[model samples]
Target: MNNENIIDIIYGNLGSMTATDQKVAHAVLTAPKDAVNYTISELAKVAQVSEASISRFCKNLDLTGFHQLKIQLAKVADDESSYYDEINIDDVQQALTNIKNNKVAEISNTLASFTTPTLKKIMALINHARILQIAAEGNTYPVVADAIYRFNQIGILAIGAESWSTSIGQTLNLITDDVLMIISNSGESKALLKQIDVAHKQGMQVIAITNRKDSPIALKADQHLRTSVRQYVLNSDYYFSRVAAITAIETLFLLLIAENRKRLSAIQNHENIISTDKI
Candidate 1:
């Protein structure tokens, strides 16, 4: 059983235990591995309860003696390698499902969290932008390119920062009419942060899309759209966060397009006229 199941078991048996036994229960719940390494007297002393409470805890878990219970817990520690191997497989599926759920939830959350003031800020920047640029590194770079497509189709002069030096140079020369939307998962990329800072100094609007709410990039952004991705095990991989990031960018693209439908229609009409004349 997992820590959650262990917690459930303790709570389920709560009514049967005395006040002192409850103290032991609380300690075990608070620090199970620590409790596993503690002796009966040591636990009772720490919990400010009696030794009998520790003995009762073992009984509560269906073990005959405290030593046997400790041995079982030790076995659990020993079996962790196999348990986690199976968990990785299960967690991959769980992470995938979580990404799907989180992607939908993020769209809803971002829409709900969005405000008129923020929209006006972004709209003003986009409306007058001479060259709207988006920069992202690693796994998130594709999202930036996709966003550029939507921006260009809607008649905005938008492009992706495909190279680091190019991104920095483009950002350095940005005027008051430029806009930069930077996407990063960890939000700690040095190059991206430097680009954002330079853009801000150069009078360009900077927007951020990231999973970490507390990241420096999010803090530095003129506007932030935060995304959340679930990590099943320890969050060492990038399965869920990438999906969340992609979905956020797509949602932003759709919303921006919807907001500028009149301009988009005018552009389409012009294109249609030119195509007909050519034919």
Candidate 2:
């Protein structure tokens, strides 16, 4: 019952949340430690909402009551406060240990954030689409390319558009039967946002895989699959976001193959042909 899990739940549900609930969520996210200490009445006052709204918010997050939320928040506060307290960057062993721990935590958090119903919807869209296009830029481009490769290996028709103009051109031709899967860690890239706008206006459905569920691109897409994990280290020069995003993409690829025998057969056939040619 880590509050990080609760925080992820709040973010994952932000698209469908009421304004009041959003206020409560924001208040907690901004200062989880403080929130843990606040009575329901204090939190209500701080968030500028009624106590009933706070109770409803807890229930929405599947917590039985406000007390349970506080318990989770207290644990999270303790963990967060101590997460980096012992780290010594000059010590190689300590640095490597810290890095490994952070990566493991991030992957676990990303996995906990996934919703089965949303994943099923994404699988269904990919299965039924007349065409599947992936849009991404910068560091995210490789992930999109990998997804395209994986889909093609299973006999699924998929393409990747990495540049702004290419994405625009690809999205322009997309019809209602086509699906565009956009990968962006921040989900706020100017280029991707433009394409998302075009895709929506052109009557095409969009699926967004991003770290921030509340980001503009996620909000614009027809369905959003969120990746939980913030970038870490070295003045933001190092990023762990890709690890989580790629993990999600691979999970989808595996699930697609699992649910479709034809896809698996296609992959096996391709392998067999390659083996025979090599022989």
TM-score between candidate 2 and the true structure: 0.70
TM-score of each: 0.57, 0.70
- The reply for model 1, stretches above 4 Å from the true place, is 1-99, 110-112, 231-240, 266-279
Model 1 has an lDDT value of 0.66
The root-mean-square deviation over C-alpha atoms between each candidate and the true structure, in angstroms, is: 14.0, 7.2
lDDT of 2 by residue, 76-173 (tens): 66555222222457898987777677566556777776789998999999988888999888977888888898888888799876676877898888
- Relative to the unseen true structure, what is the C-alpha lDDT of residue 120 in candidate 1, on a scale of 0 to 100? 66
The best candidate in terms of lDDT: 2
Judge candidate 1 at residue 279 and give its lDDT: 41
- Report how far residue 276 has shifted in candidate 2, in Å: 7.7
lDDT of each: 0.66, 0.77
